[model samples]
Target: MSKKVIHKANTRGHANHGWLDSHHTFSFARYYNPERMNFGLLRVLNDDIVAPGMGFGAHPHDNMEIISIPLSGELAHQDSTGNKKVIKTNDVQIMSAGSGLTHSEFNNSKTDQVNFLQIWVFPKEQDITPRYEQKTFNPADRQNKLQTVVGPEKDAENIWINQDAWFTLGSLKTGFSEDYKLHKTGNGVYAFVLEGEVEIDGEKLSKRDGMGISDTENVSIKASSDAELLLMEIPMR
Candidate 1:
């Protein structure tokens, strides 16, 4: 039997520091939810708003796939791999923290707050080599359809991670519909709505809403209004 989990927009854990406002979909930092820990191999999912000139300091990670998706403003990233870059809207950044790595992120603009999503997934194979990658995605390519932004293929037009999971983005017009098929059996899909409203199968979701669909090959998504969306397919193990 297929299983589904719906996460409401406001049901997530929220933390407010002087320079950071973050919402945790899974247990992280100070917010611990035994029931919300993880879905399949997907680990951390954090929606963050970083105040200008403020952000996370150097942090260490190992044997994890870390992905960052910027929504607005600029995010400056610096890592131990000698990679320093600024990520803007529609840009995706990924790091394979194999073995170990340290990095920091900050809002580049002096007056603008930067909003972004930080996600982590367990690696299929651990302790290989630390690596960093980022890319700019043309939003037009995702208009009314899915645009793959992260995958396992090196020749693909997206960032590659150290796992079999795939991440995609979509922008749909009102009343438009789309379908997403899993790349591998036993993999689950996590669909998130960034703007407007949408329906997965027959369940309605709104801005900042998320849904996990498993035990199925594909899912039907319908937009009730113009909507921006993200979909992640991950291994069930």
Candidate 2:
């Protein structure tokens, strides 16, 4: 039987630091819910909006694979690996804080706010070497179908990560349906609705809602309206 967990949009933890407004899907910083710690190897999922010219200062992290997806505006990133770049909508960025590293992110605009998703996954192995990568994806590719943006390290078509995880994005019209097969036998898929409404495994979800499915080989998804969806398939362990 398939096991499922739902995280309603209203239930997410919120923090407003004047310049930074963030919502957490799992326990983070001051939002500590013992039962909401994580979903498999997916450690953190944060929806962040930064005011013009403001953002996070340098912070240290180790043994974590960090992925950033810009929703609107642009984000400036700098890391200890000597990488510096600006990512805008349709761009994806990944940083492997293997041993240890410090990084900072700031809004690249002075008049517009920047919104993005910050996701962290526990790596399969630790203490390797720090690295950074970024790429822009054509939004047209995801129209009415899934586009793989991040995949296992050996995958040559998309950005590579240090774990057996696959991240896909889709834009669907009402009544459109799709099936996502698990990438690994013991992996789970976390579905997050970015816009409009969707039904996953028969559970209806609206914008910003999240659902985790496990013990299943494949998942069925149908759009209730024009929608945007993100699916993260990661190891259950």
* Number of colliding residue pairs in model 2: 0
**Model 2: which ten-residue window has the lowest total lDDT?**
151-160
Question: For candidate 1, lDDT tens digit of each residue in 25-101?
Answer: 88899999899999899998999999999999999999999999999999999999899999999899999999999
lDDT of 2 by residue, 12-120 (tens): 9999999999999999999999988999999999999999999899999999999999999999999998998999999999999999999999999999999999999
Model 1 regions lying over 4 Å from their true place: none
Task: Report the poorest 10 consecutive residues by lDDT, candidate 1.
Answer: 175-184
In candidate 1, position 165 carries an lDDT of 92
Candidate 2, clashing residue pairs? none
Question: Which residues of candidate 2, in runs, are more than 4 Å off?
Answer: none
Report the number of clashing residue pairs per model: 0, 0
| TM value for model 1 | 0.99
